[model samples]
Every structure is written in C-alpha cells, then in structure tokens.
Target chain A: MSPLLTFFLWSLLKCVVVTVVLLIGVAYTVLLERKLVGRIQNRWGPNRVGPFGLLQPLVDGAKLFLKEELIPGNVYKPLFLIAPIIALGCALISISVVPFGGPFTIWGSPNLFQISDVNFGLLVILGITSIGIYGIALAGWSSNNKFSLLGALRSSAQMISYELALGLSLVGVGMRAGSLNLRVIIESQTSNKGLLSWNIFGGMQFFAFFLYLMAAYAETNRSPFDLPEAESELVAGYHTEYSSMKFAMFFMAEYANMITVGCVATMLFLGGWTSPFGNLVPMPHNTFLLGLVQAFGPIMWFVIKVFSFLFLYVWVRGTLPRFRYDQLMGFGWRVLLPLTILNIVGSSLWFAYHS
Target chain B: MLLIIFILFAGLCLAGAINLLLQTHPINSALSLIVVMVSLAVLYLTLGAEFLAAAQVIVYAGAIMVLFTFVVMLLNAGKEERTLGSFASWSVGFPAVAVILAVIASVLIKSQGLGTVHLSDKITSTQELSAMLFKELVLPFEVTSVLVLIAILGAVALARRGDGERKGGQ
Candidate 1:
C-alpha cells in the first residue's frame, strides 16, 4: 500500500478501536459513578442487574435504546436533530490526538499508540472540547421551551466564563515543559527522581494543577457547576425535551469529557504513563520481559491515574452539594480567574528565576 | 494544495455570506455566520496558523456565535417588517454598487500582478504561519487588544439609553 493509503487505513482502524473503548468506558463510568455515589450514600446501587452490577450499564443502555424519542412540535426540527450528533462528534474527535501509550512496534515499523500526533495536539483538544458546548446550547434553543432556553443561556455563559480559567491554568504546564506535544510533556516527567519530578510537585506547578482541577470540574459541568442541568429549576436543562439514545448521547458526551479532562490532567501533572518508583529503582540488565514491562509502563500508569481522577469526580459529586447559580458564577469569575492569573504569573516568575 | 483548499474555502465563505443575506430567518442567519466562521478557520489552517484557526473556531464560532444565536432566539426576531418606500431601494442599490466596485478593483489588482506571486505550500503551512504571527506580526497582535477595547466601548455606548430620550419615559 502507498503511505497515504496506509496512513488513512491506520487512522480509520484507530478511530474504530478508540470509539469502541470509549463507548465501553462511558458505559462503565456511569456504573462507577452510581456505585461510588451509592457507597457514599449508604445504599446498594443496581445490585440485581448482573454479577456485582457489572451489567447494569448494559441494562441501562437497553432501556435508553427502547425509550421513545419525542420531538416536540415547537422545535426547529433540523437543528434539534443535529445538535446531539455535533456534541458527540466533537467530544469523540478530541480523543484522536491524545496518546494513550508510547509507540508500539507494528508490522516492523514503529506505530505510535495515539491515532494522530498533531503538533498542536493540546490546542486541538481544547478547541474541540469547547465546540461541544454548542450542542447543548442548540438543543435547548431548538426545543423552543422556556426552561430549556434559560438553561442553554446559563450553560453558554458558564462555559465561556470557566473556560478562561481552564485554559489559563494550563499555561504554566505548557510554559514549564516548553512543549505542547502530549508525549513530550509525559516524557519530561520521567527521570531518576521518579514521579516527584512530575509536574504536580515540580516547584510551583502544583498551583496550576489545583486551578486546572477546579476549572476542569466546572468545564465538565460536574456537580457544583451543573446548573445547566439543574433539575429543580430547568426540569432537565438542555436535554429536557430529549429522550432515548439522543439523551444518552448527552450523557455519554459528559462522561467522555470527564475522561478527556482526566487524561489531560494525568499527562500534565501525574507524569502521564510513567511508573512512579520505577524510575528510581533501575531494572536488572538485559531481560526480554523487562523491555516489555517498561514499554507498557506508561499506559498502565496513565490508566490508573485516569481512574483515580474519575473516582475523585464521583466522590466530589457524592460529597459536595451543588453550587447555586450566583455562587457558581462568583466562584468562576471572581475566585478562580484571579487565582489562575496569579498561578500563571507565579509560574512565569519562578521559571525566570530558575532558568 | 494550499491554493486548492483556499479556493474551496473561499467558495464556502461566499456561500455563507449569500446565506446570511438571502435567508429570512434570523436563526438561519446565525447558523450561516457559524459556517462563515468555520470557513475562515479553514482559511487560517491553509495559511498554517493551526492554533489561531482552532482558537478562531472555538472562541468565535463556538462561544460568541452561540451567544448571538441565543439572543436572536430570545428576541424572537423572525418577523419581517413591511419595506419602507424608497429607503429599501437605496439600501439594496448602494451596497450592490459598492460591492461591484470592490470586486472590479480586486480583479484588476489580480490581473496586474500577472501571477508573479507563486503561492508556496511551505509558506502557507501552520508552523511557518505561527512563527510569522508571533515574530514578524507581533505589533498587529498587540493592536488587537486595542481593537477589543474599542469594541467594548462601542457596545456600551450602543446599549446606553440617551438622557434626552429619558424625558419621554412614562
């Protein structure tokens, strides 16, 4: 095959694999969310679905598939239909640039674990994820319902406001690493000092990481920042009029965003896929499996880190009460924004001094 | 390759402008604006500023345009007003004449150049463009902050109710 054809086919295959894996991940994330929330609330969550409720997400999927899709008469038909697809599509597109693991040797040529390694990978992810907000806004507007419109407006403002903090918070990470490439950032974390050399504790990088986590939660519209979907005020927020698989798409998009944020946090702060103590303790010389183990090290570390963040997401959802709209906005614009700027200035000053 | 993409992008831009003009509904006009924004982003990509292109799409198309569309929807601005007598004709005629003149000037300029400027693919790629933006175009980059400030002042002025007009308030 020609190189172009090979590249095309490789990208296509990677898309399929990532889509399947993400779909499964989205499914289980809901289960994990519920199970974790249940434990926090002192209740058994979906125990009867399968062994340890492993099949609950499957059951939930079937139910959503079977549910009736209602298109209200007042809606702008075309836009209403297209909104969810756009949301899901943008959400999924971001994963392509993310390196899940280091390069794997494929058919004699070295194949990178990611679908594509664009030079502006981080910016692309940010761009696509930002675009995902339109789906929610459009859905609410197209529904032609009062509550939905209000929810959509709130969401649009909230997202734009918080996104400033979210983007700024990562500036320090980009600055310190002196590279935008995700793999390069990850590789920088590994050294003889082990994971302590990771960006989280790499001098003043922790402030940026903390700001990033907070802004990330708000960006993903998780608890305390989920006014867009505030049940008491706006019925079901943007997707109030939606049902069936259409509704499921919004849910999946949220979880997918969670995963994306988790992955980014891991890549930026937690040394990506690098083993914590593995760097400190050198391996025995010249073992075949040692190479294999080291090869898979980052991927394993990345997965574990991502899952831990996901759990933190659930824990926050369970523990914290939702923020009122005023509080949410106040925190975003007043608190987070200033802190992010401070973090940036501090990081820049620290870098200047150190370098 | 860059020229081909640019040509396609220009066509999309024209289509989007036409849609904005011809489409009766405000919502459709908003959607067309998004199409225009996205096309501009493609143009940015062809010029090689991938980061700026992405930022353009995300900030303008994704965030700002959504706000515009939401406001349009809130205002329920689809109703057509009956055309005022000769004012409508003047509105259509003057803009058309100006556009025609602008097009003629552009075509004349293109013909005068005689295709001396061979559009290099390397010059239009993202890395090259970004280097140009941050290094060579730094002044214009800083000037954009002034432009944004002007826009802010313009918006505030437009939104403020006149003191003289308040005398007639109920």
Candidate 2:
C-alpha cells in the first residue's frame, strides 16, 4: 500500500474499532451503574435479561430505537435536533485521541493501538470537552421549557467552573511526565520501582489527583455535582423535553463523558496500560504467547483501572448528597480554583528544586 | 487533503458569520458565533498553530461564549425587534462596509505568496510557542496576567451587591 493509503486505511480501521468498542462500553456502563447503584440501594438490578441482565442495554437500546421521536411545537426546532448530536459527537470524538494499548503486529501488519497520536492529545481532549457544554445549554434553551433551560444553565456553569481545577490538576501530571502524548505519559510511568512509581503512589501529584477527582465528578454531571439534572429540583433538567432516542443520545453522552474522564484519570494518575507490577513481571520468551500477553494484558489492566474510576463515580453518587446551587459554585470558584493555582505554583517550585 | 479541509472550514467560518448576522434571536446569533469560533479553531489547526487552536476552542468558543449564552438565556431574550432601515444605511453604510471588505480582500490576494502554507510549513507543536512566551516574551506575559488580575478585581467589585442591598432583594 502507498504510505498515504496505508495511513488512511489504518486510521479508518482504528476509528471503526474504537467507536464500536466505546459504544458497547458506554452501553454496559449504563448497565454497570444501574446494577451497582441497585446493589448500593439493596436491590437486584435488571436480572430479568440474559444472564444477570447482561442484555439489558440491548433491550434498552431497542426500546429507545422503536419509541417515538417527539418535537414539541414550541421548540426552536433546528437547535433542538442539533444539540444532542453535537453533545454525543463531541463525547465520542474525544475517544479518538486516547491510547488503549501498545503496538503489535496484526496479520503481518504492524499496528499501534491508538487511532492518532497527536503531540497535544491531553489539551485536545480538554478542548473538545470544554465545547461539550454547548449540548446541554442548547438542549435546555431550545427545549422552550423553564426546567430544561435551568438545568442546562446550571450544568454549563458547573462544567465551566470545575474545568479550571480539572485542567490545572493535569498540568502536574504532564509536567512530571515532560510530555503531553498519552503514550509518552504511560511510558514515563513504567518504572522499575513497580507500583510505587505510578503518579498516585510516590508521585507528588496525589493532591492534584484528589482535586481532579472532585472536579471530574462535576464535569461529568455525576451526583453531589449533578445539580443540573437533579430530579427533585430540575425535573429531568436539559433532557426534560427530549423523548426516545434524542433523550438516549443525551443519556449516552453522559456515560461516554464519564468513560472519557475515567480514561484520562487512568492515563494521567494510575499509570495507563501498565501492569501493577510494572516491568518487574517477567515476560515469556515465546513470541505468540508474548504477543497475546502484550495485546490483551495492557488492555485488561487499562479496563480494570478505568472500571475502578467508574466505580468511584458510582460510589460517590451513592454516598454523597448533591450540593446546593450556590454552594456548588462557591466550592468550584472559592475552593477548587485557588487550590489548583496553589498546586501549580507549589509543583513548579517542587520540580525546580528537585531538578 | 489540506486544501480540502481549509476550503471546507473556511467556508464554514464564513457561513457561521453570515448566520450570526441573519439570526433574529440573540441566542441563535451567539451559537452562530460559536460555530465561527470553532471553525476558526479548525483553521488554526490547519495553519499549524495547535496551541492557538486549543485556546480558541477552550477560551473563546468554550468559556466566553458559554457565558454569553448564559446571560442571553437568563434574560429570556426574544427575537430582536426589527427597525426600519435609515436611508443612510443602504447608501453610505453598505458602501462603506463593502469598500472595507474589498480592501481586505485585495490585501489578502496580494499576500498569497506569503500566506500560502505548505504542509511542511506546519508548526503545530506547543514547545516553540511556550519557549517564546516564557523566555523571550516573559515580561509581556506577566503584564497580561497582571492586566487580567485587575480585570477580575474590577468585575468582582462591580458585580458584588452591597450588604445593605443584598438583604433587601432577598
């Protein structure tokens, strides 16, 4: 194949595979949240479907697909349709930049795990997510409903506020790694010192990580930060007017955003694609077994780390009560922002002194 | 591929700007402006200024525009009330704007040799930009930060209601 053709084909293949995997992942995430939250509430969640409700997402997807698409007469029609598409599209596109596993040969063709390894993958993810606020905002406004608009507005405000802490928290990770590429960050974390060398272990960014954890919860519109769509207050919030698949898109967007944030946290702090033992685990000499290990091992570790973060998301949702409106904003601005600034300054000095 | 994307997004930018003008409601105009800002970000990416592209999206399209939308939504802004065009708007205003656009287009055409960006001319990485800002341009950067600090203070003072007023409204 011509180089350009090879590049295009490889990218196309990666995009398809990533999108499919991510969509299925998002579906199961919903199932996971329901089941886990159900357990927390002392209930069996969705056991009616195939084998402990593994097929629940499939059933839910079908129902959404077959259901009616309603457009209220009062809606500003064009934006009402476009907002959820943009929301979901932005959520999905952020995945294209995330690194999942190491490179390996596939049927004699050498392939690296990521779709595209941009130099500024982290910032690109940040920028894409920052734009995601539009979906909720436009959804609420275009819905021509007070509750929807209020929900959307609150969500946008929360995201904008928390984004500062989120972005600042990552700077410590990036600075420690000395690179913004997700792959490079992972490589930096593969310490011979085993698990102790991961950013959260001996790394000084633990406080930053804590800050990021809180901000990420708000960013994903999860509970204790989910004031925008709080059932008692906003009455379904931004998606209140949405029905069927339109609502489903917003629902999937939330899960997808959660997954994206989880992946970022894993990549930055928990050592992405690296085993707990780091490079200490001896590799088998057999090429085929090694290949299988290399291919699946990293993916398995990554999924485990990501799953842990998602579990944290659910745990927080179950554990904490949602913050009141002014309290949420106050915490974001008065607390998180100042702490992030302090962290940036402190880390800079720490790095300089250590160097 | 480069030319294709440039044409596609440049057209989008123009379309977005035109939409901003044509939209009746303030919210629609604000969204259109976001479309333009996002298109500009893409243009920056194509021009090999990745940092600027991200900043364009993050700061302009993301932060500032969200605030604009918030205010517009909060006010429940309706479609802009149309007014009768003055005789001078069609005669003097249109021509003046047209002349300005023509001059800009002429300068742009003349600068094609300089503006033509080959793929190899790409400088999308942030290293050089950061180096330039932190090393050679540090003073200006600090000055800008100070300016921003002042602006924040000004905004806070202006927006904060006095203790006497706060309780009365509540």
Candidate 3:
C-alpha cells in the first residue's frame, strides 16, 4: 500500500476504536451514576440486568431502540429532527482532540492515543461545545411546548454565562503551558515533584480548577446547576417532546458530555495520564517490558483520574440541591466570572515572577 | 485536496447565503446564516488561518448566531410574506451594487501587485497572530477594543434609560 493509504487506514481504525470506547464509556457512566446515586439514596440501582447491572446500558439501549419513535404534531419537523443530532455530534466531536494515553509507535509511525492532534485542540473543543447550545435551544423552540421553551431559554442563558468562566479559567493553564495543544499542555505538567507540579498544586491554579469545576458542572447542566431540566418545573426540559431513540440520543449526549468534561478536567488540572508519583516510580529497563508498561501505564492512570472525576460529579449530584434559576445566573456572572478573571491575572503574575 | 475541500465549503457558503435569502421563516433564515458562518470558517481553515477559523466558529457561528436564534425564538417570529420591491429600490440598489462590484473587479484585475493567490501549507500559529495584533498593531487593536466598549456602554445606557422611563410611568 502507498504511504497515504496506510495513513488513512490507520486513522480510520483509530477513529473506530476511539468512538466505540467512548460510547461504551458513556454507557457505563450512566450505570455508574445510577448505581452511585441509588446507593446515596439508600436503594439498589438496576441490580438484575447483569452482575450489578453491568448490562443495564445495553438493555436500556435496546429498549429505547425498540420503543415507538414519536414525532409530535404541531412541531417544526426539520429542526426537531436535527436538534439531538447536533447535540450528540458536538459532544462526540470534542473528545476527538483529547489524548487518552502517551504516544506509541505503530507500523513504524509514531501515534498519539487520540484521533487527531490539531494545533488548537483546546479551542476546537470550546468552539464545538459552545455550538452545542443550539441543540438544546432548537429542540425547545421546535418542540412548540411552553415547558420545553422555558427550559431551553434558561439552559441557553445559563450555558452561555458559565461558558465565559469555563473558558477563562483555562486561560491560566494555556498561558503556563505556552500552547493550546492538549498533549503539550499535559506534558508541561510533568515534574519530579509529581502531584505538586500539577496545575492545582504547585502551579497555583487550584482556584482556577475550582472555577473550572463549578463552571463545568454548570456547563454540563449537572447537579446544583441543573435548573434547565429541573424535573419539577420543566418536565424533562428540551427533550420533552422527544420520544424513544431521540430521547436516548439526548440522554447519551448528556452522559457523553460528562465523560468529555471529566477527560478535559483530568488533562487540564490532574496532570493527564501521568501518575501522581511521576518519575518516583521506576520502570523496567528491558525493551519488551518497558513497551508494555509504557503502553498501559498512562492509560490506567488516565482512566483512574477520569473515574474519580465522574465519581465527584455523581457525589455532588447526590449532595447538593439544585440552584434556583436566578441564583444560577447570578452565581455564573457575578461570582464565577470575576473570580476567573482574577485567577488569570494572578496566575500570569505568578508565572512571570517565578520565571 | 485542499482545493477540493475549499471548493466544497465555498459552494456550501454560497448555497447557505442564498438559502438565507430564500427562507421566509426567521428561524430558518437564522439557521442558514449559521451554515454560512460555519462554511466560511471552514474556508478560512483551508487558507491555513487556524486561529481566525476557530474564532469565526466560536464568535460568529456559535455566539452571535445563537443570540440571533434566541431572539427569533423569543419573538416567536413566523414566516414572513414576500413582497415585490418598490420601483425606487429596484432601480437604485441593483445599479449601485453593480457599480461597486465593477469597481472592485477592475481594481483587482488592473493592479500589478495583485497577483494570483496561492494557498500555502504553512499554518499561521496563534503566537504569530497575537504578536502581529499586540506588538505591531497595538494602537489599532486597543482602539478597536475601546470602540467596542463604547458601543456596549451606549447600549447599556439606552437600556437603562428605557427601564427608568418604564419605572417612572409605573
């Protein structure tokens, strides 16, 4: 095969693998949330599906798929059909640029554990996520339902407001790394001091991380900030009119976004796939053993970090009460926005002085 | 490959523009405008202006068009009826646009310095772009930001006045 053909095939294969893994991850995240929240609420969650509800997501998927798809009367046809796709597409697209493991050689060519290593991977993610608001917005509008519209309006306002803080909180990290590339950003966190060198510790970005976490929670419409889909008020929010697989798409998109957010948090603040011990943990000198460790170690660390982050997400969901709509808006703008700006300035000064 | 992608996006951009004009419903038109903005961003990427491309998507297609959609949705605007143009506008607008296009085309064709453009493979990094904006064109950049700030203040002032008048009336 020509070099170009080989490259194309490899990329195609990588895309397939990453996508399948992500979908599985999203499915399992749903199970994890249900189980965790159930435990928190003093009840069992999906115990019968398969061994602690391991097969719950698959069964849920099949049920959603087999259910009757409903296209409500008096709804705008095109946009109603297209909204969930836009949401899910944007959610999945953002993950394409995230690196899950360290680089490894395949077929005499070096490859990162991501589908693409765009120069502005971080910016691409932000842009795609910002675009994702349209999905909820359009879904509500096209649904022609008052509850859906109100939910979407609140969601759009909340998301756009929180996005400012979310984007600004990362500016300090980007400034420290001196690049927008995800891999470079992760590598910049490397240090013999290990956990201390991560942005939240020695980098003095714990405040920014706090801002990012809050904003991320708000951005994903997770607990405490989930005013958009508040069950009491909105009755399922933007996907109110959607049924069957369409509703599943929105559900999957939400979980997928959570996973993506977790991945990004793992990368930006937790030093990515690097161990907390860093170089303190010695590796094997033998080539074969080194290769095996190198291939698996970073990935294991990455999964652990991401899993913990998701646990935190669920924990917060169980612990906190949802913010009122006005409070959500006020906190995003009045509190988070200014603090993030302050963090940028403070980090800039710190980096300059330290350098 | 770049040329093909450019042509595809450029065609989509033009199609979206036409669709924007053709669509009677305000929401559809707004969505078409988004399509135009996104395709144009892709065209910018094809030209190797990565930062500009990202900004176009984030700022124009994502933020601005979203606000446009928000407003349309809030107003619950329906399909507008098509009407024939007035004689005065049809006579003046077409000739004026033609004259402007003619002038631009003539200038481009006649200028010796305006050679055929080539798309280079070299990508423009954000650092270089920032250097140009902050270092070489610092005054203009600051001036532009100040201008935006002024516009924002003017809007706020207008909104506040409207609120005060409403409160006084109440």
Candidate 4:
C-alpha cells in the first residue's frame, strides 16, 4: 500500500477499535454505577445475569430494543429521530482527541494511543461537546410535550452557562503546560521527575481543578446539577417523551459524557498514562510476558486514575441533593465562572513569578 | 478526497440557506442557519483556518445559536404568519444580491485571487495565529473583546423584564 493509504487504513482501524472499546466501557460504566449506587442504598443491584450482572447491560439492550417506540402525533419526526443520534455522535467524537497513552513507534511510524492528535485537541473537545446541547434542545422542542420542552430549555441553558467555567478552568492547565495539545500537556506534567509536577499537586492549579470538578458535574448533567431531568419535577425531563432505543441513546450519551469528563480530569490533573514512580517498569523488547507488563503499565495507571474520578462522580451523585434551578444557574454564572477566570489569572501570575 | 468533501459541504451550505428561507417556523429557520454555519466551519477547516473554524462552531453555532433557541422557545415563536411577498423582495432583492456577489467574485478572480505563501503544515496552525493576535494585533483583539462585552450587556438588559412591566398585572 502507498504510505497515504496505509496511514488511512491504520487510522480507520484505530477508530473502529476505539469506538468498540468506548461503547463497551460506557456499558460497563452503567453497570458499575448501578452496582455502586445499589450497594450504597443497601440493595443487590443486577446480580443474576451472567455472573454478578456482567450480562445485565446486554439484557437492558434487548429490553430497550423490544420496547415499543412510540412517536407521538405532534412531534416533528425528522428532528425527533435525529436528536438522539446527534447527542450520541457528539459524545463519541471528543474521545478521538483524548490522549490515552504516550506515543510508541509501530514499525517506524510514530503513533499515540489516541485516535487523532489535533493541535487544538482541547478546544476541539470543547467545541464539539458544546454543540451536544442542541440534541437535548431539539428533542425537547420536537416532542411538543410541555414537560419535555421546559426540561430541554432549562438543560440547554445550564449546559451553555457551565461550559464557560469548564473551558476557562482548563485554560489554567494549558497556560501552565504552555501548550493546548493533550499529549504535550501530559508530557509536560512528567518533567518534574516525581509527584510535584502534576497539575493538581505541584503546578498550583488546585483551584482550576476544583472549579473544573464542579463545572464538570453540571456540564454532564449529573446530580446536584440535574434539574433538567428532575424526575419528581418534570417527569423525566427532556427524555420524557422518548421510549425504547431513542431513550436508550440519550442514556448511553449521558454515561459516555461522564466517562469523557473522567478521562479529561485524569489527563489534565492526575498525569495521563504516566507512572508516578518514574519509569520503574522497564520496556522489555524480547520477552513476551515482560513486554505485556511494560505495555500495560502506563495504561493501567491511566485507567486507575480515571476510575478514581468516576468513583468520585458516583459518590457525589449519591451524597448530594439536587440543586434548584435558580440556585444552579446562579452558582454556575455568579460563582464558578468568576472563580475560573480568577484561576486563570492566578495561575498565569504564578507561572510568571516562578519563571 | 478533500475536494469531494468540500463540494459536499458546499452543497450542504446552499441547501441549508434555502431551508432557512423556506421554513415557516422561526426555530426551524434557526436550525437551518446552524447547518449553514457548521458547513461554513468545515469550509474554513479545508482552507487551513482551524482556529477560526473551531471558534466559528463554538461562538456562533454553540453559544449565540443556543441563545437564539432559548429566546425562541421562551417566547413560544410559532409558525410565522404567511403573507404574499411584496414585489420588491421577489423581483428586485434576489437579483440585486446575486449581481453584487457576481461582481465581487469576478473582481477577485480577475485580480489574482490570492498571493499564496506556502507555509509548512504544522507552522501555519493555531499557534502562529495566536502569536500574531496576541503580539502584533493585541490592541485590536482587546477592542473586539470589549465590543463583545457591550453586546452581552445589551442582551442582558433586553432580556430582563422591566420594573413597570413586573408591577402591571398580566
């Protein structure tokens, strides 16, 4: 094959592999949330299917598939059908730019574990995910249900408001690292030779991380910021009119977005795919077993960090009560946005003074 | 390959603009405008303006359009009342706009369309663009930001219900 064709084929393969893995990851994440939340509430969750609920998601998929897809007479059919797909598509596309592990050579060509490495990877993510709000908004309007419309309106407003804080908070990291490339940011964190270099610990970006955490919860529409889908208030909010696979699409998109937040947090703060102990695990070129160890080492650390973030997400969901709409918007705009702006300024000042 | 993609997006932009003009409801028209904006962003990407493309999506398609949708939904803008087009809009409007565009395109094409200074792929990206903006044109950049801030303030003022309206019964 020509080099251009070979590159295209390789990228296509990566895209497929990443998509499959991410979908599975999204499924298992749902399982994990249910089990964890059930355990928190002193219940067994879904333990019967295929040994400890391993097949539960598959069962859920079948159930959704078999359920009647009711399209109400008043709905704008095309927009209704396309909304969930857009939501899911927007959720999945950002994963292409997230660097999972550092670059390693295949034959002679260099490639990272990520699907693609755009120069403005972080901004691309911000732009793509921001557009995901349209899915919820369109779903709400097309449904012609009053409850769904109100929910969608509130949700879109909340998302766009919180997005400012979310994007601004990350600017601190970009400034500290002096690059917007995800891989470059990760590599920059590894330069301190120990724990001090990570954005959270030594880089003095704790406030930005703190702001990011709070804003991320709202951006993902998780608990405490989930007014858009308050079951008691709006009857399932934007997805109230949806059923079967349509509703399933929204559910999967939410979980996938949560996973994206976890991954981004890990990459930005906890040091992406880097062993904290400083290359203690050697890359064995010859032995199969040791090579596996070497290959999986950074990946394992990356996974561990992301899991910890996800655990925090679930824990926060269980522990905190949902915010009232007025309070949520006020906190997002009046509080988080200003604090994030300050975080950027303070971080830049710190960098300037230190240098 | 890129040419094919460009043609596809260009076709989408034209279709979306026609949809915007044809749609009866304001919300649907807004959505068609979004489609046009997104296709335009893709076109910008093909022209090696990656930062501009991202900003176009983020600022226009994402933020400003969301605001439009919110206002439309809040106000409950139903289907616009249909009316016969006045003779001026149909007879004079389309032809005038087309003539102007044709004149501009002809002028540009006749006068050496562009002076291409080939830049290495990576070097012509967002980093260079930002360097130019922050270093050489920082004053104008700051002034443009202030202009945006004024627009935001005006929007807020317009959205807030006045005290007189609040006091009056609905």
Best by DockQ: 3
Name the 10 consecutive residues with the lowest summed lDDT in model 3 chain A: A103-112
lDDT of each: 0.84, 0.90, 0.91, 0.87
TM-score of 1: 0.89
Which scores greater on lDDT, model 2 or model 3? 3
Decreasing lDDT order of the candidates: 3, 2, 4, 1
lDDT of 1 by residue, A196-293 (tens): 78899864689888889999998888987889999988899999999899999999999999999999999889888777884566675878867777
Write the residue-wise lDDT of candidate 2 on A121-162 in tens digits: 998999999989999999999999999999988998899999
Off by over 4 Å in 1: A108-110, A284-288, B1-8, B79-120, B123-140, B150-170
How does residue A91 of candidate 1 score in lDDT? 82
Instruction: lDDT for model 3, please.
Output: 0.91
Kindly report which residue stretches of model 3 are placed more than 4 angstroms away from their true locations once superposed. B102-117
Prediction 3 TM-score vs. true: 0.97
Q: Candidate 4's residue-wise lDDT over A292-350, tens digit each?
A: 66567778888888888888888888789999889998999899988998888898899
Per-residue lDDT, model 1, residue A337, is 98
- Candidate 4 regions exceeding 4 Å error are A107-109, A280-290, B87-123, B156-161, B164-170
Per-prediction DockQ comes to 0.52, 0.73, 0.75, 0.70
